[model samples]
Target: MNLTTFLVYCVIVTFTPGPTNIVILSSVQHSSMRQAMNYVLGATMAFGLLLGASAILNRMLAGILPSILSTMQIVGCLYMLYLAYQIFRMGSAESLEQHPSGFASGLLMQFVNPKVILFTLTVIPSYVLPYYSSPLILMVFVIIITVIGFLAFATWLIFGSVFRSFLLNHQRAANTIMALFLVYSAVMVSGLL
Candidate 1:
């Protein structure tokens, strides 16, 4: 396997300004560190499971993906819209108590995330398959990428936490920026981006 290329792709896709990362940042800015960590754990675990499932069902995925891909995209788009609305409504605690999206929500959110599915499908076939097609190796790669994904979440969370003071001082600007990212993510998922 092209370890450098795969790792680079993983880092870009996992850490980029997508729905999950934006939400993690927003969560840290609006809520507690612990709350954001819950989301990270949930997203990380769900992504791992999805990656493994995709690798194991690679052959079947080709046929199944076409049928379900649009539906997943639509669901993810709508969910992103909802999240965008939530972020837009964010304000001071006294004016608007913005609660972090909980662990279960984060876990379920990963299932319909277009980026995750697309990455799993494309990366396994394009990168991993050429090197090793064994089930064991695929599973290992899935686990590795999942851990990488978790680190991505941690990075975003830290980025947000670092800006906690700035966000507190300029809550409206922060919320608007985060909300815009979510809307951009929705557009990307809907294939308009």
Candidate 2:
């Protein structure tokens, strides 16, 4: 693989705004850095697991990718909509108290997050597999991708931390914007656009 191309794809996908990142930002804004970090840890684990699975099952998945992708898209879209609703309703820290942004929620979110699912599924085959077939190499790539993902989540958390005051002052507006972004993400990934 062209290292530059692979790095670019990985960075672009993970760093871009998505459901996970939005939630991380929201978590930091509404909760605490500890909560955001917990979510990031879970997300990082799930990301690594997905990449490992992709690398191991590349050939088998190729035969059934269409079915899998369609199913995932449906599930992912619905989940995203649910998250959007939750975000839309979270106007205050009190409201967010009931909302879960912990490790389990973060792990579950990745499984149903289209942006993450698609990236994990495609990145390995498109970039890593083509260039390296060794299990060791594949594992290394997975670790690298997971680290990138962790960094992306961390960046979002830091952003929210930096703007916590503004976000708290405009809590309703911030929630609305994040909710709308999640909705837009859902629509875009639903194959309806």
Candidate 3:
């Protein structure tokens, strides 16, 4: 396996604007940095599980259960729309409190996240290990990707957290920005479906 190729994949996947990052950014803007960090942890855990499962089962499953992929895509797209709505409806940052349940909610959200699952099932297998077949090597690759993803997502959350004070000062403008993000997410999801 080429380390450079894996690193490139990690950079691309982690840096892209996706549902996980969107949620983290919204949460940080509305609540606290600590809550956003919890979300990062939850999302990282979920990504790890998906990566591992795809590494172990993607080949057999792809051949036998093609419908499963379609189902996942639909579920993921719908969930993203729901998340967008939730963000669009939220009140100003000061009125919103950090919820303890956000950690679990963040983790579960990744399960239905089409992009994450697709990357795990396709990109990891195809680009990361085009010729390699060793399970240990694949597992190591998955772990590396997961770590990179965690760091990248955390960076976005931190950006939101650090700028939250500025957002709080201009409540209406901040809400408008978030509402636009919701619309953007919805449009992206519709394109996917």
Most lDDT-accurate candidate: 2
Model 1, global lDDT: 0.69
Please, what is the whole-model Cα lDDT of each candidate in the order they appear?
A: 0.69, 0.72, 0.63
Ranked candidates (lDDT, high to low): 2, 1, 3
Q: What are the runs in model 1 whose C-alpha is more than 4 Å off?
A: 59-99, 161-193
* Candidate 2 lowest-lDDT run of ten: 90-99
Cα lDDT tens digits for candidate 1, 84-185 = 676677554323335466688679778888767666655565456545767788788998999999999888888765544565687787677767766765
Pick the winner on lDDT between candidates 1 and 2.
Answer: 2
Clash totals in order: 0, 0, 0
Question: TM-score, each model?
Answer: 0.64, 0.65, 0.61
lDDT of 2 by residue, 11-98 (tens): 6567645678768877887687898789988988898898888778873554456365455556556766776786678544333333
| TM-score for candidate 2, residues paired by index | 0.65
The most accurate candidate by TM-score is: 2
In candidate 1, position 8 carries an lDDT of 60
Q: Which window of ten consecutive residues has the lowest lDDT sum in model 1?
A: 90-99
* lDDT for position 30 in model 3: 65
